[model samples]
Target: MTKRDNASQSKQFSIYLRSTNEWIPVTKEQYKEHSKFYGSFRKKKQDHCKCTCPHQKWWFCNADCETCKYRTGGDTVSFDFMYFNAETAGITPLEFLESNVNDFTIDVDNKLISIEIIHYIQDVAPFILSVASMRLKGLTDTEIAKKLGMPRTTLLARVNKTADLIREKFPDYNV
Candidate 1:
């Protein structure tokens, strides 16, 4: 079969094997059976965790609270604080991991400044915040433009505008 035909066939008949982390061709009946099993497993897992913290929901919880690294300690902050910081900063914890910021301080004082800046951007132009987040995810200008369905030049212009706004608003701090 041609490459396009193979691609179409795979899309039609493939089942992802979670254990092997790969997709394999399967009969329609087999795919249906697997989907039923997987759906139940997902629902069960979603309701497994019983933690009270808002950040400790089933999907995001590690399920080992006794030895969790985020537990209160000498230098570690609580998971709730970390979640709040990331939320206020307008990014996910995973996005913070992908960031270039060296000092990962979890205290409120340090995060407050960033949170203020993010809130300002969010208030002024929410689109810039989305574009900035995509940029933070290591997307190139071309890729960001394509994903946002805008021209490359328009994306560049928006980026420049955001920088200018930041510089104007927070002159003491470098952008």
Candidate 2:
């Protein structure tokens, strides 16, 4: 698929929490961990009728117009694009994760562990210092993982943990 298609491969989670009556924007990772899922619902096959369909943008025919029934005096077709977990919907995944005392969060909580994670990023700073360094030099994540003799999964976890540390350290900085 194209770049746009690849971009859309990732899903966004927008939550309307019933208890708080608030809209919470969550990250993609959060969506994966704490929710039932659905989607990648690209519109396919149009109708052949002459009636105008709202899904024309998806290139459907007139017969496919039923799918866009709002134009046909029907109430708009409300699709559950993603899984609706009435139970989970009332609470956010991040809040759920935070409630559980997971290893990742606990590691992040300890000052020594936090410093170690921060150091990993900082230690790599010089390696990333040059303007062209990011573009030109050295190992990719996979390569670095191999060189450091760590599993790719471990490396990724470390990197993710480091990034979380940065965010926690400077919430208002918008890193």
Candidate 3:
């Protein structure tokens, strides 16, 4: 390949620099240098949670430490580390399902929906409840419309109507 072709190809292999908050193209040599720098920096920055857990030997807190009922709040760790550690631990499907339930209200962007409001929606407009449930499960408008056998526009209209109903009935909700 020509030099220009090689440069373009190298552009496809890019690495993100967290410190710089940028994704930069890397040639093989540059990639090796960056990898070495990152690896050494990571090694130098190695830290362990200072929690009182007996199994605090790990570099980072593990699932066992997190789940231990006796765990007192220790040194606050970065959110990224906690998220990755949780991913490594792996939650059961039952745990995932149970976590979604809230006793009273579902809060989204400061808007609250109480259990009574949910029951009101079920009694007055059952379809709205279904749409809301599907939306909560991370379904897009198009996907929900397809599943409900309705047009995209109709789905949008229903969503708006549901919002309007909530606002009208529970003005304090600010939906």
Candidate 4:
């Protein structure tokens, strides 16, 4: 292929928007900015943009983004980037579904990875993250318990609880 043909082949195609029933004539990379711009101002279910809160006007002290409530999030509700990217790239919906990249494996035994799993675990069972990470670093339950200064039984209990949660969230997967 010529240099121009190669360049064109490497380019991303437009995506079809279900909401407006229009084709977004932009590559996936280009859509990043477009999605962010539109996602921020995108209307919510209540017909109000999430940025209704005046972020520029600080209400209280700001230590960093971690403690800052004014920090805006990316447009998750407005656009399905994965679906759009796959469609624009001329991939089938089923192919897209099978090729998920949002998961992380802790070990060969329990390949635990999913955005929902991570978010829920972080929000509700935060301690599990420490346990999982330590275990992944080749630490035994006893060593983890000693390092964390918790009882081995307690550590084991939390691990079991985390496993239960994973099973609950992903029934088909062998946690």
The parts of candidate 3 lying over 4 Å away from their true place are 1-113
Worst 10 residues of 3 by lDDT: 53-62
lDDT of 3 by residue, 93-168 (tens): 4554456655223555234457768777887778887887898999998999999999999989877887788788
Worst 10 residues of 2 by lDDT: 37-46
Cα lDDT, all candidates:
0.65, 0.50, 0.62, 0.60
Reference-based lDDT, residue 49, model 2: 28
Tens digit of per-residue lDDT, candidate 4, span 27-130: 76776765555444432411432233343332222223334444455343423343446345755555555555323223422533566678878977798888
| TM-score against truth, every candidate | 0.37, 0.25, 0.35, 0.35
Prediction RMSDs, each to the true structure: 23.2, 25.3, 21.5, 24.2
Top candidate by TM-score = 1
Displacement of residue 138 (Cα, Å) in model 2 is 5.2
- Per-residue CA lDDT of model 1 for 1-175, tens digit only, reads 8999888667766665434557688887887777676455444443544233343332323334455333333334343444445345655555566553544554555678789899988887788878878889999989989999999999889879888998999897776
The positional error of residue 99 in candidate 2, measured at the CA in angstroms, is 47
lDDT, residue 71, model 4: 41
Q: Compare candidates 2 and 4 on lDDT and give the better one.
A: 4
Poorest 10 consecutive residues by lDDT, candidate 4: 55-64
Q: Kindly report the root-mean-square deviation of model 1 from the true structure over all alpha carbons.
A: 23.2
